[model samples]
Target: MRRPAHLTQGRYAPPVPRRTLDVTSADGSRLYAEVHGPEGAPTVVLSHGWTCSTAFWAPVVRDLADTHQVVLYDQRGHGRSPAVPPAGHSTRALADDLVAVLEQTLAPGERAVIGGHSMGGMTIMAAAERPELRARAAAALLCSTGSADLASEARVFPLPTPGGRRQAHRRLLGSRAPLGPVSPPAKWALRYATLGAGASAEQIEACARIVHACPPGVRFRWGHVLYELQLTRSVSRLEVPTAVLVGTADRLTPVVHARRLASVLPQCVGLTELPGLGHMTPIEDPDAVAGRLRDLVRDHLATAPAPRGERPARQKKEKTA
Candidate 1:
């Protein structure tokens, strides 16, 4: 398999986690999770996209860990997380894993600003209505993801007909082919499909390494799930303040998906469209992604009111008095 130069050189390595643990999901899958920064700080939990690992969020994590307790995790079968059985692959599984991570990582009554990229965003949507999510998530950022019609809307194939494009995307998603080598042509293809025209060598290398590290079988399984995704109801159920971000040139989950999400989300805080960027918005513009996350942490997560079901300890004590 072809690996990126940075993977060997450690140029864009993920920040060392203060602690690492295996979080057991509802179905008994052990997800690899890491926590960074000081305890008791406002928390930010991040989920990565399809065919990507926790390392994919390195740039953003590096920026956030200075002031926020940043949590990063690999999806089942990706990164340090071991491959799960075939039956364990689905949007529902994604939701279950996310809930487990939140439950295992946070202290009681503490909440986080959760950010998901691509498939990770879909995971948030899948868990939107769950009591665990509502209790643990103060705010959310959905990046480069859609609720449905993924294959139909993706611009990966420049075919003339919509049917042709959709068919091509489906085949591509279902393919178990390995990304064999990171040659110049391979990098070019990666850039065309995922990144902006302006992505630097280092950014491309970082993204390439993370993506290529994913096992082909695992990629095929998750890609098939994405191809058939339908989480519109989940998006509607996401009651927390949410922000949407997408690149104008995104081929995977286009700007239209972002627009639809903003329209349907009950409490959408904002939609940010980055011009000329592609599906890999976080890597394409790490500063912008990190800045938006910081804004959400400051404006929403940090000051979010306590859950309606729970009274403050002082208030409860006064009531007893």
Candidate 2:
């Protein structure tokens, strides 16, 4: 997807990557991946959610780049990556593309703390049992995602009857409706459906542009997959030090998902529910998300050296104590 200049400029402007790679997935679809920060530092690979690109991680990357080598990739049919190939959109394809990204970007035998937001989190869970993910994932951060009953549980529309809600949500999920330009009404709808009440105009606009940039066909395909998603078994198989985070006000994937995941994750380190943030956690509260990641790297990846500038106390001290 080609993003407009204003949408990718200013505070959310993507960090200049150290290198960008055109990764080929198992089915021969090309994936776009960018590596940022320093080489040889403790690595962290970030996967953006549905309807987002590497640009979604701009704030988080800006915060983490000083001490961490950050990697960002666009999922199939999103961002600069070519549209989905003939293999079709499925959880398996998500898993395959993630594996392909790791295989291409990481040095052999090198592991990194991996993190995902929303569908990106599902990508990690979907790839839980894969040997490649198992080999290269030192830890994981699951932010605002669910493994099962996603359409049923989502609070986006808040319909009255159970059957009606499910039906309505399904239609909303797989509607193939075109999201027009980021107009004020479009921002209002996006804000109501996806973001928290406290979202600023800038945050809403940034999210609106990204969400609108996604092709309706691509959105429809992924939406259908999510509508029928069944990944509870996979969540149990994500046997790594994993932390789950969610926005209490998230309409898309509520805190219930985070709670369920916390209960099921094999080695859950923590579950954070931000009081008023929404589904766009990375963009809304980049500092908190980035801070949690820093904690994970310090606690789980201390053996791996950081770049020269960052001091140890900076990494360890929650000194605002």
- On TM-score, the candidate that comes out on top is 2
lDDT score for candidate 2 against the true structure: 0.86
Q: Model 1 clash pairs?
A: none
> What would the TM-score be for candidate 2 when compared with the true structure?
0.93
Model 1 deviation from native, Cα RMSD in Å: 5.4
lDDT of 2 by residue, 71-102 (tens): 89999998888887434699999999999999
lDDT of 1 by residue, 1-321 (tens): 433423544536877799999999998899999998766566889999999999888889777776677899999999999999888999999999999999999886678889999999999999998999988887899999999988888898978877888899999899999987667888888889999888888888888878877899999999899888999999999999899999999998889999999999999999999999999988888888889888987776544323333333311100100
Local distance difference test, per candidate? 0.86, 0.86
Candidate 2 minimal-lDDT segment of 10 residues:
312-321
Off by over 4 Å in 2: 1-6, 85-87, 304-321
Off by over 4 Å in 1: 1-11, 303-321
> Against the hidden reference, what TM-scores do the models get?
0.92, 0.93
